[model samples]
Target: MPGALAAVSDPALRAAFREWILRVADDELVIGHRHSEWTGFGPDLESDVAMSSIAQEEIGHARAFYEQIAADEGSDVDRLAFDRAPAEYRHAALLERPNGGWEFSILRLLLYEQFEAARLGLLAASGQEPVASLARTLVREERYHSLFARTWLERLARADAEGRARVQAALDSAWPDALGLFEATPADGVLRAAGILGEAPEAQRPAWEEAVRPVLQGCGLSIPAGPAREGGRRGLHGPEFEEMLAQMTEVWRSDPEARW
Candidate 1:
């Protein structure tokens, strides 16, 4: 692997960098789309507007990362984002699952934001050029996202037994998928070996769990016990992802040559 990203000349290393970038970008894109679904349906007017802003911010983050990859690969950002087949996306399954309900989305956001922060922290000082810088800035945004999720989580937990049970159910269902966020691929080894990823995804897992456990337990939620579900990193996904990809790509696929 090259010390300088601009001087990356090895095919395998370049491929690994692309894979790492796509993993982060795809997560943002898919989760952004999921969040956008709540645009006009949030539990309140303020929440509706706030979530809409966060959704757009997530999409913007995705575009930034995609643009970085596009610059290197001589590919356009939209093509990289919308032109890919469903099997080509590298996002975790946690993000691709449908937003089951307000409780579900809030729980998923709480879990994912913690993971995202841990991920960015690993990259913060990795000396990985543009991505390190990107991570530094993105982590700030994630703090707000985490805060929003936590506030709602606490509210629901304290509301009543029914509210607490609903949140607990959502957390149970989402825990396995959230664990999948750290499922490593072969490319992860390449990045770790090259010092591009300061730590392995597996190493990040305990920290992620530790960060979320206190808050979740305080809310009367228990972490699900089991092996993490996998396959999303390798592009395997379920019907929900297929439906999402269809809707996401519809406008672009309608006329590939048309300008947006």
Candidate 2:
């Protein structure tokens, strides 16, 4: 994204940079939190450990990226994290939507982790260095994250009718909104012009769809063809997001200025 950030001196470009960063932040933060809900609740021991690691990696990633941006603002990362109002969060509605069960969470991970892998690949190739370097490193971790999800997917795919039913339904439920992950903003053109994005951010959606469709199909699942849900990028969220935001910020928002 070095090329994409080359023009960040421009106010519009800078704002775009911040917005895209926030969106990425929101994605990691919420999904990490959602996955964390399974800390001790996974169906078995190995899965419990694996899911916990994934959750930690996500929150850790969010913190690292937030630190990079926070330094420029003369503030710390946590404020931008737990201190924000739910309305201020920019994660996709899909992520904030409650995890119905273990299989549901795994399905969500299977879909989003693949999308994240591609996004990180794009960032790694972006002309930016420090952030690009961060993205490259995170992608390596994400490869393992994705492999874990795929392992579960293959096992769950071959499970009994009821297990397959639950997993398949979760996939269908998460598919369309997964597209929300790529909702474009004015920042998109800036990122593109700055050479941070390989192309217009919107251009990646169809390719992402094509890239992952086979995985779902091979599982005997079909993409949930529905109207695209939007607004998470702009901090617009749904009822589920509202509940999640309140619970997430409960601790930090109580005394935001206090040093932890």
Candidate 3:
């Protein structure tokens, strides 16, 4: 990793470059797995369908990012995803947080999709053609995700007294880690200096906050303020990830060498 950083002229820029890209990939995998639990069990038929689509898209996005890195390193994406230990995962605490209620899950999806959109937009213009191209294609899928998040957020927030409160509470709980998405790393400076990415975490973070703030406000929600609880980018995550990992790899682990 340090060798990759040394390739960049600046320390901070390279760290930032790696930080965002890795964070993006980890967040998607964790959240996608979380959401996949609702495949046949959401609040209603339409909702189940919508949430399943979101879950598939998120996992698909993660596969795209993970496969790229795997291809670069001659590794296997399936092993990277399903066979890894929890501590090895780089996803955020927020992604591993349990889905309490359907409304809460919807709210979580809303916030996550928003963050994913901005993250991909920045990546799409990184001047790293291959990575940037992946980001561009991801944006196409993320657009659908945003539309789903917005529809559910607005509907739930305005539906009834209980619905409004539930969505609001979900927002309050998720806000802290939403900011955690901006956590920086040692490579931030090198990415920019090497022209591998567009902006450092220091620069991209506030812009992301500003951009996301309006969306929250427009949805009648409050922005969270706190020292962001981090560690997701550093391969630190919540306990829920362990449970999720077991479930995700259960069938695959049953017969390691068996072919379908």
| Local distance difference test, candidate 2 | 0.79
> In candidate 3, which residue ranges exceed 4 Å CA deviation?
1-21
Error of 1 at 107 (Å): 0.6
lDDT per residue, candidate 2, 86-201, as tens digits? 78788887888898877788778877887788888877787666767888888888888878887888788778888778888888778768888887777788778877778675
TM-scores for all candidates?
Answer: 0.96, 0.92, 0.87
Compared with the true structure, model 1 gives a TM-score of: 0.96
Give me the displacement of residue 203 in model 3, in angstroms.
2.5
After superposition, which runs of candidate 1 have C-alpha atoms over 4 Å from their true positions? 1-5
The residue-by-residue lDDT of candidate 1 on 1-260, one tens digit each, is: 11224546678987888888888899999999999999999999999998888899899989988887887767688999999888999999999989988999988999999988887787677677777888899888988999999999999987999998899889888888999999999998998888778888899898898889999999887777998999999999899999999998899899988876
Top candidate (lDDT): 1
How well does candidate 2 score on lDDT at residue 206? Answer: 78
The number of residue pairs in model 2 that clash at the backbone is 11
RMSD of each: 2.2, 2.6, 3.7
Q: Write the per-residue lDDT of candidate 3 for residues 1-260, one digit (tens) a residue.
A: 12122333454664455456556777898888888989899888998998898888888888877776566456566777777778877777888888888877777777777777777877777665566778888888877777787787888878788877888898888888777776666565555566665666557677667766787777677776778778877778666777878888999889766666
How displaced is residue 129 in candidate 2, in Å?
A: 2.8
**Which of candidates 1 and 3 is the stronger one according to TM-score?**
1
